[model samples]
Target: MIRILAFVLTLGMLAACSAPPSSTGDEVQRLASEIRSLGPDIDPVEAERAARIAYSYSAQLAQEYEITDPPLVHNAKVNKGLRPRGLCWHWAEDIERRLDQEGFETLEMHRAIANADNPFRIDHSTAIISRKGETMRDGIVLDPWRYGGVLYWSPLTEDTKYEWVPRDAVLEKRRLDQHGALLPYVSG
Candidate 1:
């Protein structure tokens, strides 16, 4: 009886551990919807242009492809002729520019060098935008071009380190930020 009970318990634990977290497709769809809703609230002309650009690139990436990173996917579909990894920074810069043109106060930040002792450098950028006070938390969305996903704000102080926000954490942060109406967390 003891052996059987232990086996059953172990099996249950394994099943739980192996289960996948939230689907990326559903999360992306939610973020897309949120962006669309916020579009009308922005300045009309700029909003239209920005929305068109974001939507167009997003759609292109959704087409059949093995790539998953949003920025990379966008670049690949739009510029198929270019070598892989050639347009990472270019796409980020383009997104930053469009967001700025849309009248949303924007900021671009770059990751610091790995270490003085090491020759390697880290290349990543994040965008921050200002929105109505009521929409503060949801204001900052990290569209990691190399990683095709959106991350929302959390209680992430400068000290909290993470390569990427877990999908559940991203969704929770989105809700909390939207609830509190606090500005997006920005790191120097």
Candidate 2:
């Protein structure tokens, strides 16, 4: 009986995720305000456009991967490397590349490293953005990998959920260029 119920619930979620992306960019001013609320001095217009771009990319990826099914759990253990949508890094990397291409004049996006620091635990990856030249700690975490295709965001400094270490863009770029190379300075 429990399995049957879970199956039904999963089917419902699958239906929901197949629906079109929620944001049509029709409410640009409203989205801008929402972005501003997350951080001071952010150009809501740019943020909104960037956000919409990310959302579109995520939605397309989710559809391609058939993750529109949503999932029984948002937990990492369950969501592990499921492919196309697997791994938080995939989402972060994909979105980061897209945003990077668009170019945020006032915003600086950084590869945020979660301070897992434990050998037993793996480091979680995500991307963040801030006013150019502003401290990365005070940036906005754009975690689009979690919660299915839903984007999760929070203040990097006040979140307290994860201690983050940033990599020098130059070295980090070199590290990523290696492809399958270890992330420098990450303890995990």
Give per-model TM-scores.
0.34, 0.61
**Predicted candidate 1, C-alpha RMSD:** 15.5
Please give the lDDT score at residue 122 for candidate 2.
58
Check candidate 2 and list the clashing pairs: none
Q: Please give the range of 10 consecutive residues that has the lowest summed lDDT in model 2.
A: 68-77
Worst 10 residues of 1 by lDDT: 106-115
lDDT of 1 by residue, 1-188 (tens): 99978865764554344322344554444444444455355444443454455545533433423344334334445476543432434444445565555454322222211122234423334343333443333443434343442233221222133333333454576588778887767899
Report lDDT (CA) for all predictions.
Answer: 0.41, 0.64
Query: Runs in model 2 with CA error above 4 Å?
Result: 1-31, 37-42, 68-82, 167-188
Steric clashes per prediction = 2, 0
Best by TM-score: 2
What would the per-residue lDDT of candidate 2 be over residues 8-37, giving only the tens digit for each residue? 686677546634335555543443555566
RMSD of each: 15.5, 8.4
